[model samples]
Target: MLQIDLWKRVLIWALVVAGLVLASPNLFYSRVEQHNDAVKAIEASGATPEREAQAAAWPSWMPSNLVNLGLDLRGGAHLLAEVKVADVYKARMDALWPDLRDVLRPERETVGTVRLQPSQPGELRVRISNPEGMTRALELVRGLAQPVVSLTGAGTSDIEVAGQGSDIVVTLSEAEQRATDERTMQQSLEIIRRRIDEVGTREPTIQRQGTDRILIQVPGVGSAAELKDIIGTTAQLTFQPVVSRTSDAETSAGVGNEVLPSLDEQGTYYVLETAPVVTGEELVDAQPSFDQNGRPAVSFRFNPSGARKFGDYTAANIGNPFAIVLDEEVISAPVIQSHIAGGSGIITGNFTVEEATNLAVLLRAGALPAGMDFLEERTIGPELGQDSIEAGKLATGVAFALVLAFMFFTYGLFGVFANVALILNIGLMFGMLSLIGATLTLPGIAGIVLTVGMAVDANVLIFERIREELKTARGPARAIELGYEKALSAIVDANLTTIITAVILYVMGSGPVRGFAITLGLGIVTSVFTAIWVTRLMIVIWFERRRPRTIEV
Candidate 1:
């Protein structure tokens, strides 16, 4: 009999209604977006009257989830940046120098006086006064080497040590270099993501391109330069012992020391030890606040490890000046008044309120492991995005109208049923996208238009089968039942193949390609549900109410 179970019928209608309700907010996209933003702001900070009104623009009980727009649709900043992975090598070698000096100090009778010598980048050279103790120096430095912490680098040490005349040269091994490059790239991606998320942008794409390059696409940013400014700041904060303050920029910083100009004082340079007491990586929290003199400053709190190091350094070096360095420039050189405990400190500089807040944001987000050189940069204007949206709307409307007209005229009453189901299917597809928070691009719109055409295939097959069934002298009810049963295999087979293809595309592709795959995959699921179940239920209801003796297909 051409009848659906009562529970099944009710479930079908419930799903249809739910999908349409979930998709209804997209009809007033801008208003719902503003309401969603207002709600988020109210949660983050207390709501004002204007924000309250915006939040009230939409009903509270309704679903507020929206399909996020992609970079193409929303307009954004695009950048291809090459990371300077070699920069980390220099820092690694500099940090190794202090450890090497400490280890060789015990052997001063044999190794004589161990002194840091100027060397090329990525190499640490230590010169000993006595050449006869070269074997002892090499043995001690090589003893400090540890096995690389990687599967491919198993059995290889992190550093390679060799004797060159009276100097011992230490450099990172090849396996360790590869590991460091991978770590540097991963850290850069994370820091860039955090920095962009701090600004509250939607669905920004931050991904690694090659071995040492990153691709960043941020939607709703004003320009590429603005996006760069937000993420490009290295914000590498370190506290080091200040050797001396000098006005001569060309003055030699001496071995194991570097010269950095002061941020607040022009023409003032400070020579500081290359090794830091504590780095920004140890910081747990940073916030903008006022100092004792009521000036804008950034207050920072460190983790336990950082706190211990900072406290020990300050306690042992009372009255000695320590340089606070940011991105290789000395921000402040302040004398330690006493043992500053608890690992909390303030960085006071010549900064406006906005600068202090931005600095705090960068500090909280953490520093990039390596510097980035912008290889390609582009800014897409919102006006262009609006034009693209309008074009997509026109194409979708035309395709929908054409499909609806063709379906209605070709199969008469059955075609009208298919048309109604098609509408519901479109709504269901959007509902799924919103629920999943999928990003919609221009290619995604094309997938929707394509779906409108493919959605009526099942109904057409069923209608043709019924036409043949009616010729074989079957009763109207039996013909309709057999028609649906026969068409079910074909519909499932066709949609199943398409869904598999969509899955493959999604897995192998990226960015806009994945957007298209998402829409296509979701469309097939909704189309199959509407074609096989919703249309059948509607036809069953009509036949029951009419009690027609015969039906024309």
Candidate 2:
């Protein structure tokens, strides 16, 4: 035995073995993660044909692969949903004008046929529709306290109400218009958030940018095609005028009311009421279930006010077929079905569980404003990801093999000792990534490859120092002792700079950059122990077991 400290060797081995123990959980957890599914299963419908039809429908609930796969490797969809701020602003302008007109209608008319219309700078144009009445109303309105400032237009002497000058404007100023746009973006994001939550996918990110766009990322979501369909749909519910059977036969197929309850007259569908009775905002909850006859149906409950409104409408309509149109397509139109006084009702149709589920999802998600057209869509497939993993492993193995060969040939026995430490360090990195749930991406693999070469540098420093120490004619014990002590300062100084760079990268990076940073950071710490400490301890054990007369580099 080369009379070296056994305690130091034992401590070094303890760190390595403890790392293995700590990392073991990641291996076991990864197995479970691999087997997890991403799709949800719907309960079977009793209709054999319907159930058979649904047999091909994959479950929406995915139970595994929580970490996001990169776009190149995984085939998934990507979409950029533009909020259409200008369109929203226009709609808001149209909707708010009526309310303002009504609020000031009495005064404007009281002043004898005054006209009120939208103008610049919260401006409104008010002229005498009835000159005699307008004169009386204006005197009262001018005296009444309000935030409005009145002006006369250039071409005509019409009174202009504006925050700025004589422009006919509504209550909404430039700031308010911007605020409305901002609110639309926020509300749209909320709606998107709710929809994604219902999807039950893992690691999905939905972020808002500026005043008009939303970015969504779903890690393991396979059906990005369907995801865009779900997100792009505004889901707006309207109370439109409906034409009955026999009235518009040419416009629609007057099928069995069972097949098409919402057809117009003459076996055609009715023109839906252009003015909505109530929006979809009142819907509280929805679920897919079987009716008493075991047929697929969507059961929905409304808010108290919606329930009362629905009841009133049904009670008045009697046997009229009322339509439930979502995004302009009639989903269901049951004949006033015996007065749904409870504010809850069922939509019965020839629907499968999957069909009913999608409806439930849309209803639960509420509707979007206007017609939200899709701007962009991208779908990713998982086959590519698996192939990338294989390729990454190949490249990593090649680099590691090269490192192993170089180390074994370069320093001879001491190099062999460092190579073993390098292998353990890689294992330790893997185990920790698994344990901590760090996703391994292509860039992360690159970091691992780079670390393999880096780990060798520490060994080289120690081995070269040991060779220089031998010139002093010291014993093997003293030579190794001086070598570790001398290499410590340089090793720490070099790796500290790396760790600092890694910290900066992590702070400034996003997604894959962060993944690379994490791998690099973990590598640096493990390399310090394995390269500096592990090698020294292993060499000591070698000396103790077979104490050689002269240590060869």
Candidate 3:
């Protein structure tokens, strides 16, 4: 005979899981101010083209919303970016053919004109007048010696322009195609992350899923329409127009910073200026750090050329403040007190460590190649989120009560035992959510409710089978034994199917769908233990103590 204490053991296990789930979220990132309002969630960047923009990702405490609410159910921006494979191929050709032309110094007498075209595998085609010059060009290309940093491939087939007449087209070698794919995918992701940072996406999550596909999720974004405006903008960048501050009077290089005045996008007057310093193009990496007194700062390393330029510039203007301008807001304006000879330096500002570190990640990723297109944007008011959460709780409570009542009325003592286990199952799921630190969306609450309603199905299967065994005129002990044994196969099959389905959903889906799948998956495992072991132990204990010779439903 099973002991009543056995059910208690399973119940206790359930409690431990519940406790863990409830304590997870607060364990990560520390915060300065709590979020009280979503409408005023973040400081407004004032207004733009009749629309106001707010930081939608997370609080200043966390650089990423890696654990925050996703779009759909919480609502935010969605964007799709397609890397320019064609432009990549074009750049390869442009860089290659020029060098190949220089190499093919086919005696000017042998060839009049050499033309280039595209081919498969991202190779370029080069053609020269006079078929005989092809041999010379090919030979020159074969023997060509120089570093082709971004462009690759050598020899006749690599420079494959074998058509008729004076023009030829070159195709990319397989190696070149492979290299470009990697560069574009990596660069595109970094560029998107940078633009999001520049525009102040608090904790935006940008990841690459496939070769050319990137997935971006920004939480608390209030304007999806604005995101559509930003996401598609090519945003290409380069180091151009390097001029001294004295070159333009209107551009102004004011000395002695007694609050230098500047203009905002609206052409309004504002005091800003620490004079012009070098742009961010030459930066290699940046990280968030703390100073000697533990104040927030940003540290950065530069490329060799940039280091030389920086050392020279600081040596020349030791007392002048150099502005660290980003997205047109002067982030910092520190005086160049001495040479940064080691090619690395730090940016100190009125910043929290998180904010400073995020800025470094942005700078390391480099400026966007072009101005952004806000493909999507939106925000969730905290009031609404809180209200919805409360409503979900009420709904879950009602569902649980209804399920408990139905099960108890139908199955009697065993049903009561299932009810107790179900409560613990609920607690376990919540505790795990807290422990795992998953963001709870409205759909996630629905998942919990659905689990509550469906979790008892397994218990019902076992109980009903027990009833069937008793109808065969079996003794109480024999009935309960056969009941659980006979039903185990069907129980296993059903739950396995449910688990597989959840796995497929989680694997293929994103955002809320994924959240729903996780909750459902966890529910299945918890339900099996409660239904099979906890409920059975209670039933057996009751039978043993009461000594009921005949079973009662």
Against the hidden reference, what TM-scores do the models get? 0.97, 0.68, 0.60
CA lDDT of each prediction against the hidden true structure:
0.92, 0.66, 0.62
Residues 291-379, candidate 3, lDDT per residue (tens digit)?
77788988788888877877777777676656555554434455667766867877666787657755665676675433332333345
- Spell out the clash pairs found in candidate 1: none
Error of 3 at 126 (Å): 14
TM-score top scorer: 1
Order of candidates by TM-score, top first?
A: 1, 2, 3
Worst 10 residues of 2 by lDDT: 254-263
Largest lDDT belongs to which candidate? 1
Off by over 4 Å in 3: 3-68, 80-182, 190-215, 222-284, 287-299, 303-341, 345-361, 365-372, 378-398, 472-474, 540-551
Query: For candidate 2, lDDT tens digit of each residue in 1-553?
Result: 2344667767777777766765654444444333332113233224455444443333224222233345555555677777766665444444344444455566643543434433333233444455545434444433332332323212232122332222233334444455556667777777887887676655455767555777776656666677876677676654433445433434532211112224122244545543344557888988898888999988888899888878787787877777776665566666764767887877777788888887788888876653444576667678877788789889889989999999888889888898899989987777666556676677887888889889888888888998999989997778888888899999999999999999999898876787799899999999997887777777877887887778888
Tens digit of per-residue lDDT, candidate 1, span 48-80: 999999999999999988888888889999999
Please tell me which model should have the higher TM-score, number 2 or number 3.
2
Q: Could you give the candidate ranking by lDDT, starting with the highest?
A: 1, 2, 3
Q: Give the CA lDDT, 0 to 100, for residue 176 in model 2.
A: 47
